[model samples]
Structures are given as C-alpha cells and as structure tokens.
Target chain A: MNITDLDTPTLAADLDVLERNIDGMAQHCQQLGIPLRVHTKTHKVPEIAKLQIDAGSQGITCQKLGEAEVMVDADVDDILIPYNIVGKPKLKRLTALVQRARITVALDSEETAIGISQQAIADGCVVPVIVELDTGSGRCGVQSPQAAQRLAQQIMKMQGIDFQGIMTYPSNVRAKPFIEETLNLLSSDGIPVNIISGGGTGSEAASKEIGCTETRSGSYVYEGMTRVGNSEMLTPERCVLRVIVTVVSTPTPERIIIDGGMKTFTSYPPTPYGHIIEHPDAKIYGMSVEHGHVDVSECSHRFKVGEQLSVIPLHQGMTSNLHDKLVGIRGDQVETTWQIAGRGKVF
Target chain B: MNITDLDTPTLAADLDVLERNIDGMAQHCQQLGIPLRVHTKTHKVPEIAKLQIDAGSQGITCQKLGEAEVMVDADVDDILIPYNIVGKPKLKRLTALVQRARITVALDSEETAIGISQQAIADGCVVPVIVELDTGSGRCGVQSPQAAQRLAQQIMKMQGIDFQGIMTYPSNVRAKPFIEETLNLLSSDGIPVNIISGGGTGSEAASKEIGCTETRSGSYVYEGMTRVGNSEMLTPERCVLRVIVTVVSTPTPERIIIDGGMKTFTSYPPTPYGHIIEHPDAKIYGMSVEHGHVDVSECSHRFKVGEQLSVIPLHQGMTSNLHDKLVGIRGDQVETTWQIAGRGKVF
Candidate 1:
C-alpha cells in the first residue's frame, strides 16, 4: 500500500526515522552507562516497546496500571509505574498484576505506602517502591531530602514492599543536591538503592549527571527531541509520526481547511499547531474540533481540495492517544500498522 | 454498582440530568415547529443517539464518515454529514455508507462536488448534498450569497447527486441576510430548496428565527447549554456529563493532584481546566500529561489522598473523544455503561 493512497487524516510514522530515534537513544544510554527504561506512554504500542527493548532498553515504564497490564499481556517483562496507586479498586488490580511480572511503583506519602504495603502483603507478593522527590517541579513528590528519607524509612520497614532508590520527573539541576543528600541518608542506614530513575525529552544527560541508574524516556521515540550531550535536537527530520490530511475547503486566499483538527492534533505547545512537511511557509493559525484552519496567504503553492499534506503534530504523545492504529511508512510505501493498544488506559 | 466504587478518572453521565436535557431540547424544538437533528459528535455514543432520536429528533448529524458508519451499523437511519467528502478512499467509503442509510454531505467547492459525484455515479448511488455557506464562521464555507448560488447551480449539473437545501454552523444574525438572499436566488432558478438546516449549542433559537426547517444539536444530551428561546442556560445543574476523578496526592496544603490530566481532560476552553463540584472554591490551575494541577488555596475544606471529586469538563465534546466508555449514573448507583463507539472516527 502506498502512503499517499490512504484515507485523509491518517497517522503515518516514518519507519526510518523511528529506527534512527530508537538506535540513537539506545546508543546514547549505553555510552552513558545508564539503563534506558523506554516509557510506553508516548507511543502506547507494545510493538514499539519491543523495538526499544530490542535496541537495548533495560525495561519499560508505564504511567498507569492499565497500561502495564496491556504490556504484560504482550509478554514484555520488567515494568515500572511511576504514579501513586490509590484506592481499593486499583489496589486489587495491583495485587493481581504483581503476581504476573516484576512490578514497581512510586510513592510520596505514607498513606500511599500503607495502601500498597497492605495489598502486597495480603496477596503474598513483594512489591518494590521508589520514593518520589519534588526537587523543583511541584507536581507530586516529597518536598525535601529529609521528607524523601522519611518516606523511604517507612517503606523499608514494610514487610511486603521493598524500598528501592528514588525517582523524579524532568531531571534537572535542582534534583542533584536533593538526590545526593537522600542517597547519603539511605546508605548510612544500610538501605539498598537499587534504582535511581529520572528522565525527560531534553534531560537525559542531566539524569545521568544527577546520579540516576536508569532514565525513563518516552517522547524521544516519536518526536525525537533529545538534549543528551547534543545527541539530537528538535528538528523536522527527527519527527517520525506525521498526520496525513487532505485539503477539504479553501474559504479564502488567506485560509484553507484540513480534515484534522483538535481531535487529530492537540493544543499543546500552544502556538503553531503542527509542522507541515509540504508547506513549511503555511501557518496553522487555528483549530476547531474537526477543522484545521491553515493560513496559506504567503505560500506560493496553490492547494487543491483533493491535495494531501503531511503534518507532524507538535505533541506526538497526546496525538497518539487520539488514534487507534498507526501506519508505518517507509519511503512512500506502507510497511506495517501498529495498534495504539495502550491508549485511553487511564485507570 | 455505586458511582463511588468505580475506578478513579472515569467518565460518567448523570442519567437524570441526561433525561432532563434530552426532554428539554425535544420539548423546545416541538414548540418551535422545527425538526431536531441531533449531532452525535458531542457524545459519540449510539445509545445517546437513540435517546435523541426517541425524543423526537428527525435524524442525526455526524462530523465524519467514520462516525456515520458506526451509527449506521447500530441501525441509525438519517445522518447529515455537514462537511465536504474528498479523496478517493473516503469517497469509496461514502458510497458504501449511502447504500446503508440516508447520507447527506455538504460541499463548498466544485472540485469536492465533482469528486463525490464521480464516486457516487460509479457506485450507482444518489448522494444528497447541501451548500455550505460562510455565515461569518470563517471555517469552511462558500464566501457570499452569490457564491452559494453559483455552487448550487454547479452541483445541480452533476450526476448521481441531489442538491439538498443549505446548512451553516453557529446560526447567527449574520446568517439571516445570506440565507434569505441565497434562498431567493436558488428558488428563482426553479430549484426546490427543501431543507434549511442551521444549528449549534446555543444557537438553535437563532436557527429557527433565521428560517431553518431543522436544527442540528449534539451538546444538549450532555453539556445541557441551549438558547432555543431561552430553553436552557449554562449552569452547574444543567451539565449532565461529569468526569469523576480521584485525588492521588496532596503535595502541599494549597495544592492537590488529580489523576486526570491533559490525556484525560483537555486544554480546550483554555482556562480553568475543569469545574470541580466538590471543591467549588478550588481552581484547576494547570495540567500535565497524567496529573491535573489543582489550586485549593482558597478552599475552606481540606483534601486527602484517595478522596474522589466530580468535574464537569469545560468542553465536553472534546473531552468525550478521550475516553472509551461513558458510565451512566442515577444519583449514587451505576445504571449502564455505553461505549463511546463513534469516538476517534475522524476519517
């Protein structure tokens, strides 16, 4: 099948670029002596997870248990969920999941720790937990190194839960002091720090510099923006996935409408919705629920109603969740189709 | 099952409020002497479409052929696709779809008309087409009243195509003069204009006042905001659909983290991500991919981990596309679960 011959508003990923990104990140991590835990939240496809592991990723990280369940069903081993698992319903599911694979979770509060510890003990399974520290990003974590050490101490005393190292998101310089102080406190008490996980799109080198044993990187698989020792940058050529949309209506000389909209693209990165591969001069000025308003007044190209344009969505992770399957294309030919099975698994 | 017992970050619609909204819109349209064609984009559930049809809707409107196919497979009868159908792949699907049920498509260009007409002719099907006028929306439409007549004349000359009347989104005061002038011009050419369809969430009364025979409304089933002769208004009690989420972490006294975030909710109305029912004084200040940053600085009540809250998304239609099922609830008990079967059908 040819790429251009498919239906409009279709999600097509460049297989060449995908391989390049996978190989690039795996090599970068291997050289830095830090294991890369490919975060499955970006592509949400188990096939991509296999590719990352084949490229030497140590393991995979999931944002929720629902996604981890999908991966476990696919025979992928070693999963890490970096969010607090709260409530009885999730606890029951967590107990069932730990029986199937190597499961690890994160915690920032004693209440979260108690819930998981009780569930793990009752299910006759041991669960590994990492203390989450705030560093600087004030989303979900303990405030200071002392607070993290306290949480780690409580987790260590639990019978069924093993206290791993620590993890924080978007590894930055602020995490350096906090992680170093907490590591000193834990080691002095004779506690093992097996895993120190940290990562983001442009913060891989920082994750290694801040003393992380593993980095959970998700966006690097598709959008291809990495700042690990200048390994990769945010370039159009680095982006693997492209949304193929056709020109549906030309309301005026200054405006044209594509079939993809807020449902296909996203409002993340706020301005300049997408990067049009065919017409870089064309500005995607606005978007409705089902319409992509494009500004082509400055472009010399005269777009027809049936002509197709490829758009690389600014935020590929959010956009991947909107579609069911992704078409893998190699040079104008369709190679494979991967179902985004982990989408909408927010449970 | 009780609503509180369900998993965290579940999409639930209040059955009583859903019925109140459905009945209110049906009664309002009954008094106005206009047929109501429910737009299925808001809910994208076949059961909700059936409810709207049972409540005196003439038919339903789908934004894309993919959604129209889902409705057709579920035995939905009349569907109006108020967008142009271009490209051969979509044209083939549209031909097969028109064979199953009554499918009406809208067109604003001669190229789009020729493409659909050719495919319909090859498949031996008569496709109903409506002339899309601008009406100040600046999205997808013919520029002026004269341009509408010219497109209608061209469409009338095409084979395997029936020229239905006209349809415009967001029926406003600006649509009055354009629709009236086009009606005169189209009628003088001895062309019968049978359907004058115009609609939006808060523009149904304007649709009737501007001489529309039927209005397409979809948000009334869930969000419950309408302006059909003051039939309803935007209020907390009016919103039928509520996204039930749980507080996973309280990082600070002033801040709490909900499990729902950009992937669960959306960045659509741009400010105040969601209206928290439990914490009325609380503000949803920010959103990450899997965490909703909530500001409870002004709230008198204290929040705890594992506590649940109800949130009505500002843009329910966009948020509806993010989930797979809509749980129907009556007070505290779960009534039914409807698959969002028509979601992500943006073909």
Candidate 2:
C-alpha cells in the first residue's frame, strides 16, 4: 500500500531519509573513532536496530528491561540498559535477559547494586554493572568521583556482579573534568574501567573529546524538530519519521483541525507540538486528546476536508512510543511495515 | 496477583472506586433526566464500556472508527462517532460498522456528509448524521446557527443519510443561547431533532440546563487531577486510575527518580505531570523518556529503592491510552486484567 492507501493519523518513515540519517551518524562516529551504540528507544523497532547494527553500530542500548527483551528476540546479543533496575520482578526479568545476551546495567545506589547481585546469583550469572555519574544531566547518577568509586567498590564486592565502567547521559564538554576525575579515582583503586559510555544526540560530537568510549544516541536515527533545531548535522530533510494526518475540518478561516493530536503526537513542552511539512506557515498552537488545533491565518494555502498533511513531531521518542507500527516509505512508494516491538514496554 | 507482582510503570484501576464513579455518573444523569452516553476514549477497554452500558448509559460515543469497531465486538449496538469520517478506507470500515450496528457521525461540512452518504448507499444502509455546532469549545464545528441549518439541509437532501440532531463537546452554560438558536432554526426548517448531545465531565451537570437530551462524559469514569481540580464530584479518592511506578533511585535528598516518565505518564504543560498519592507534597517537575524526576524535599516520607508509588495523572484520557492493559485492583490485590482493545487504534 502507498501513503494514500494507509489510514490517516499513522506514522510513516521515509526509508531514504532514514538510511541517510543512519549513515550520517555512523560516518561521524567512525571518523571520531568512538564506537556508536544506537539507543533503540527512539524507533523501538527490532528491524531498525538490526539495520543500525549492520551499519556499524557496536550494540544497542535500551532504557527498560522490557525493551531489551524485545531486542534479544530479534537476535541482538549486546544490550546496555543505562537505568537503575530495582524490584524483584524486574531483576528476575533482567537475569533472564542476561542468559540470552550480554547485559550491562547502570546503577548509582548500593541498594540497587545489591538487588541485581542477588538476582544474578540466583540465576547463576555474573552481570556487568556500570556506575552512572551525574556529570551533568542531574537526572540519575552519583554526584562525584568519590561516590562513583564507592559504588564501583560495592559492585566489585558483590558475588555475581562486576564493575564494568562509568556512563552518563547527555554528555557535554562541561562534563569532561568530572569524567576525567572519576576515571582517575577508578584507576587509583585499580578498577578496570572497560567501558566509558556517554552521549546523547545533543552532545554526540563532543562525546569523544569528553573521553566517552561509546556514544549512545537514540534520536539520531529519527531526527525530530528538537534535534534539527539544536544540531548543524541534522536538517528537516533528514527527518525520517512523519505523522501523516488528515485535515478533518476547517471550522473557521484561521482555525484548522487535524485528525492527530496529543494522543498521536508528543505532549512535550514548547508550543507547536509538531511542524507541518507542507504548510510551514500554519502553526499547531493547541491540541486535545484527539484533535490538533492549527492556526492558519497567515498561511495563503487553503486546506480541505480529507486532505492529508505530514507533521514532524517535536519529540520523536515519545511520539514513536504512542504507536504500534511504523510504515516505512521510500520516496512515494511503501517500503515495509515494522512492528514497534517495544511501544508500551515502559516497564 | 498483586500490585507488587506486576512490573513498575503499569496502570492500575481501583475496582471499588470505578464502580462508585460509574454509579455516581449514572445517578447524576438519571436525576437530570438526561440519557448518558459515555465516551469510551478515556478507558478504551471493552469491559469498561460494558460496565458503563450496564450502569444506565444509553449508548457509547467514540471519536474514531477503530475504537467503535472494538466496541462493536463487545456487542455494543448503538455507536455515535463525534468526528468527521473521511477517506475511502475509513468510510468502508464505517459502512461495515453501519451494517452491524446503528452508526451516527458528526459533520460540519457538506463534503464529509456527501462522502458518508455515498458510502452508506454503496453498502445499502442509512447512516444517521449530526451537525456539530461550535457552541463554545471552538475546536470543531460550524460557527453560526445558519451554518448548522445549511449542513442539516444538505444532509436531508443526501440519499442514504438522515440528519439525526446536534452535538458539542465540553458544553458550557454560555453555549445555551447558541444551542437554543440552532434548535429554533432547525425547528423552523421542519427538521426533527432526535438527539441533542452536549457534554464532557466538566459540563455534564449543566448539560440539561443548557437544553441537551444527552451528555457524553468520558473522564468521569476514571477521574484524573484535571477533573478533581475542576469539580467537587471528583476527588483523588474517587479517581480509579493510578500509575504504579517504582522509586528507581534517590540520587539526592531533594531529587527522586521513578521508573515512569513521559513514556508512561504525560509531559503536558502545567507544573507537575502527576500527583503522588502517598506523598502529596512531592512534585513531578521533569521527565526523560524513561525517568520521572520528582522533587520530594518537602515530603517527610523517605522513599526507598523498589518502593512502589501510585500517581494520579494530570489527564486520565491520555494516560489510559498509553497503556496496553488496565490492571483492575481491589485494595492491594489485582482482581482482573482487561485488555485495552482500542489502545493504539488512532486511525
């Protein structure tokens, strides 16, 4: 089926743009001599993760255990989850995942480390553990080098756990001194830091300079408005994903309503939830659960009922998570349909 | 199974509160002498729709054909879709639905009316059509009473299509004059208005006073923070839905990270994305794809790793759409797990 043949309010990825985005990031990482670990959280499709692995990505990174399980089913062998896995139910699932693939988890607290260690012992497996440092993204991680050292020591003492390395998200140039200090402290303790994972699409180019061995960037695969606005490397032309919506009503001359809304797109802050590809002048100012209210007063073009429009989401990661499948398109033709295996795998 | 047995970042509905909510709305509509037509968009589970119908709802209202299809499988005979149905594929599905059940569609444009009429003719069926009036929501509908009369006239002229009545969402007291004017115009034109649906939980109490025969309230079944903040009928205690998330990390005394985030809950505007049921003072200020950054500095309770906290979302409709299934709980025990049959049917 072609674009018109598919139902409205569906997500479609341009294959040509997707390949270019994949190749562009791969080449950049290759030039920097840093192993690229593509985060599968953005696309959530196993086929896209496999494609990334084929295009020179070292492995895949998932934020949740349920997502890693999906990747394992797709024959992905190496998976690094850069989030603290707590609770017996989740740890048991993590241990099962460790049996099928090389699983590495990041933790900042001793309580989390102890839980993983217990689960690993029960499963008779040694799980590699990474100490997450709060080099800057103040979301989750140890505050200082001394804290990282302490966590690393705790992991080393555990029976079925090994201290792998250190990792941080949204790694920037400002984090260089902190990362260096942490590595020095680990080195002084004679701790073998095999992996120093860092980077998000926002700070990917500076990851290697900040001493990150591998860059884990998810949005680079399906560049959204946020990435395109921040990075010189990305453009709207390279945006692979688009929410194809139909103009269901134009109630007034200024106000237009589309079939897609917050349920179909991301509800992330910053007005204009998405950018209209064909009608750039038309602003998507408001949204309800199922209707996107667009202000098209300045636009010279007129929209009619049943007319379709392509929109690039402000946040691609959350938008992709809202859908079950991604319709892959090449030029004007339909290429393939890939199931978003980890769509609601928030656990 | 219990709440602890399930993984973190899952949605759970309190069965007792759910039953209370259903009975409360049913009683309110009954007292007002208005037929209640509960919208299924809030909780897309067929079981919940069945419960609403059993609780005295005349029929069900859905925004999309995909959702209506799921309700049809659950043996719902009357379905009113309050959105303009466009495109050949969607019309084909709507026509098939018309064959099985009584299907009514809301339209403001003649093009949409003609489309549905032609599809109904092809399928040898008559589809009831309602002219949506722009009373106050200003989202989708005709502006003036004359426009509504014109659309009704067009519908009356079309073959295999019957002009049923009028409807508006989030109807308020200010819309009373508009509804009266539209009704007067239709009466003057010799049009029989069978149904006058005006709704949303925010204005359900005022619907009858505003001259509405029926009220379509969705979020009333599972009240969220928005509803609780708006009406006295809803309270945090009355809210049936809660996102049970685990405290993954407490990086600092002030900052606590949960397993739920933008992917699990919503990142919509207005300070906190959700309200913590256990810790009312804790503020959910920020979120990444998989991490909910909450500030618990003011709270006296200390959260430990693996501790589950129930969160009342800002909007129940969007939060319900994010989950694949709703874990129905009574006290601490999971009573049932209902599949959200229309979860990702955004088409």
TM-scores, all candidates, are 0.96, 0.97
lDDT of 1 by residue, A38-144 (tens): 99999999999999999999889999899999999999889999999999999989989989998899988988999999988888988888988888898999998
**Model 2: per-residue lDDT, tens digit, B1-347?**
87788888889999999999999999988988888999999999989999999999999999888999999998998889999999988999998999899889899899899999999899998988898998878899999999998899888999989998999877788888888999999999999999999888867778888888899998889987677774333345778888999999999999999999888887765668787888888899998878999999999888888889998887788888889989999999999999999998888
How does the DockQ of candidate 1 come out?
0.78
Q: Give the poorly placed runs of model 1, Cα more than 4 Å off.
A: A224-235, B224-235
Question: Which of the numbered candidates is closest to the native, going by highest TM-score?
Answer: 2
In candidate 2, which residue pairs clash?
Answer: none
Instruction: Look at candidate 2 and tell me the lDDT of residue B296.
Output: 95
Compose the digit string of candidate 1's lDDT tens values, residues B9-60. 9999988988889999999988888789999999999999999899999999
RMSD of each: 2.7, 2.0
